[model samples]
Target: MKAMLPESVRATGADILLGNTYHLMLRPTAERIARLGGLHGFMNWDRPILTDSGGFQVMSLADLRKLTEEGVSFKSHIDGSKHMLSPERSMEIQRLLGSDIVMCFDECPALPAERAQIAESMRLSMRWAQRSRDAFGDRPGHALFGIQQGGLEQDLRAESAEALRGIGFDGYAIGGLAVGEGQEAMFGCLDYAPDQLPSDKPRYLMGVGKPDDIVGAVKRGVDMMDCVLPSRSGRTGQAWTRRGPVAIKNARHADDPRPLDETCTCPACTGYSRAYLHHVFRAGEMISGMLLTWHNLHYFQELMSGMRAAIASGTFEAWEAEFHAQRALGDIERV
Candidate 1:
C-alpha cells in the first residue's frame, strides 16, 4: 500500500491518511491486520488514519452484492467467496483495524435516482447509523462519524442531518454526493449541507473531486474531503500542477527540457526534466508512476497550504482568482 506513497514521502505533506475498510477487510483481512498491530503498524504510517464504512463498496460494487435492511451480502470480487457487511460488522472491522476515525455504515444511492428511492436509502442508512453507534460503544481515542445521505434533496439532507445530530457522533460526513452529481449540483448541496450539521464538529464531504472541486468545497465550509484523483491520474502519466493537468506522455514533452512546472519544488520537477519523465512513462518504467504520484501529491498539498494561508489572511478570494487565472493560462507553451 505504501509502495506508491511511503510514509516518509506522504508524511512530509499529508496531515492525515485515509484507509479503505472494504479492501482491507477482504484481503489480508481485519483479523490479520489487528494481529499485526492494525493499519498504522502494517502500513508503517504513524499519522492519524480515517477508514470508511464499506458503504461505498456497497454502491460501487452493486453488481457483486445484495442489499437488505440487515446488511449487504457480498460475493468477493477476488475469489467469489461470500461475506456479510452489516453496521455491526463494519464497526467491528474498523475497530480491528484500529482506525482513529470510523465512518457509520450507510447505503449511498447513485445520483439521478428517484426521490422515493433516495428517501428509502437515506432512512435505512439512519437506522444503520444507530446500529453502528451501539456496536462501536465507547472508545477513548477513537471517533465514530455519522454520514448524512439524502442525495440532492434539501429536506432529506436536513432530515438526515437531524437524525445524525439526534444520534450524536464525534463527526459528520456529507455522503451520497460526488457520485456522478455534477460539480454545480455538489456545490449546491454543500451550500446548505454543512450548515445543517453541528458547527463545532468536522464536516467531511466524502469522495470528492478535482482541484476546483476541492477549492469550491472548502469555500462552501466543507471542513474536509477525500478523493483518489491525484494518484489515479498520476498513474496515467498526468500531472496536477499550478497551471493545470499536464499530460506527461504527450509527444510535445518527449523532447522538451523544461520542469513540469517552473515554480514546482517537488523532486520530480526539481530533479528531473520533462524529457526524462516522458521517457520513463513511455518505456513503462515503475518509477514513472512513483515520481509523478509524488509530484501530484506535493502539488495538492501546496494547493491546500495556499488556501489555508489565504483564509487566515482574508485573501481567499484573491488567492482563488489567481488559482483559476493560472489554470486558465494552461500548460506553458514551448517558448
Candidate 2:
C-alpha cells in the first residue's frame, strides 16, 4: 500500500483507499493500531477506508481451519498460532481500526460445493451476520455492510440477501463467487445477486477482478469493488492497458519507444516509454513496480469514472460494448 499509493494520490488524485483486515489483524493487531490513533492516523490517509472482516482469510489461507456454527478456529498462516475468529471479534477489530465502512463477518465457502453444503454455509453466515450487527452497535459516520455468500446458485444468493436485509446493514456485498469460478459463471451469479438486495443501499463485490470484470460488475448494478490484482500484477511486470493486458518485461518491448497506453496520463504513460519500462523491469528496479502499479490503479479509477458517467447518462450498454471492442485489438503500434 505504501509502495503503490503515496505518489499516485498526488499524481492522479484518489478519494478513498481500502485496507485488508486479514493482513492487518495478523501483523499490527487492530487494538495496537487504535492505540496509535486509528487506521487513518496510523497510515496518514485521511480519506475513507473500508476494512473487510477476517472471515475470508480464515477460510482461504489457513492450513488447518475448522468451521462450525459458532465461528472458525484456525492456525495462523504467519506464526502457526491457534486462534478463533467469531463475528463479534471481527466487529471489534474493524471498530478498533476505525474504518468508515465495516463488513459483516460471513463464511465464504469455496465454489462448486454441493447444494446442501452451500445451504449450510449460507445459513451459518446469516446467523453470524446478525451477530456482527449486534456487536457493531452504532456510530454516526461509520457504516456496517453485510456479505451475501451462497456460491453461484441464484436461489441461495437470493435467500442470503433477504436474510442480510432483514438483519439490516448500511450496504450489501456479493461474496463467494470470485473464488475460482470463471467470469462467465461469476457474471451469471451477479445477474441475480445485486437485484436481491435493496437498490438504495450500496452494492459491493469483494475481491473482484480484472479490468473487464470491474466493468461488467458495475454494469450489473454493483456499486463498489476491491481487489489486490493491480498491485499484485505490478510486482510481476504486467500492465493493464486500454487495449488489454501488456507484459512489460517481454522482449518485444525492449526497443519500443512508446508509453504503455497512448490515452493514459499516468507517470508510466506520460514520462516513460516502453523500452525504459522494459529495462527497469528486467533489472528488478523498484521504480518499475511503483510506476506500473500507479498506471493500473489509475486505469481502474478511469474505468469507474466512465461507468459512473454512463450510468448517470443511461448509456452504460454502449460504453460496455466499446470497452470490450477496445480490448479486442491486441498489440499494435500507435503511429
**TM-scores for every candidate against the unseen true structure:** 0.98, 0.97
Name the lDDT value of residue 296 in candidate 1. Answer: 85
Over 107-153, each residue of candidate 2 has an lDDT whose tens digit, in order, gives 88887789999999999999999999999997899999999988888
RMSD (Å) of each candidate, 1 decimal: 1.1, 1.4
Q: What is the lDDT for 221 in model 2?
A: 87
lDDT of each: 0.91, 0.88
- What is residue 258's positional error in candidate 1, in angstroms? 0.5
Candidate achieving the largest TM-score: 1
Clashes of each: 0, 0
Give the candidate number with the greatest lDDT: 1
Q: Distance (Å) between predicted and true CA of 293, model 1?
A: 0.2
> What is the Cα-based lDDT of residue 326 in candidate 1?
94
- What residue runs in model 1 are displaced by over 4 Å at the alpha carbon? 1-5
lDDT score, candidate 1? 0.91
> Using alpha carbons, what is the TM-score of model 1?
0.98
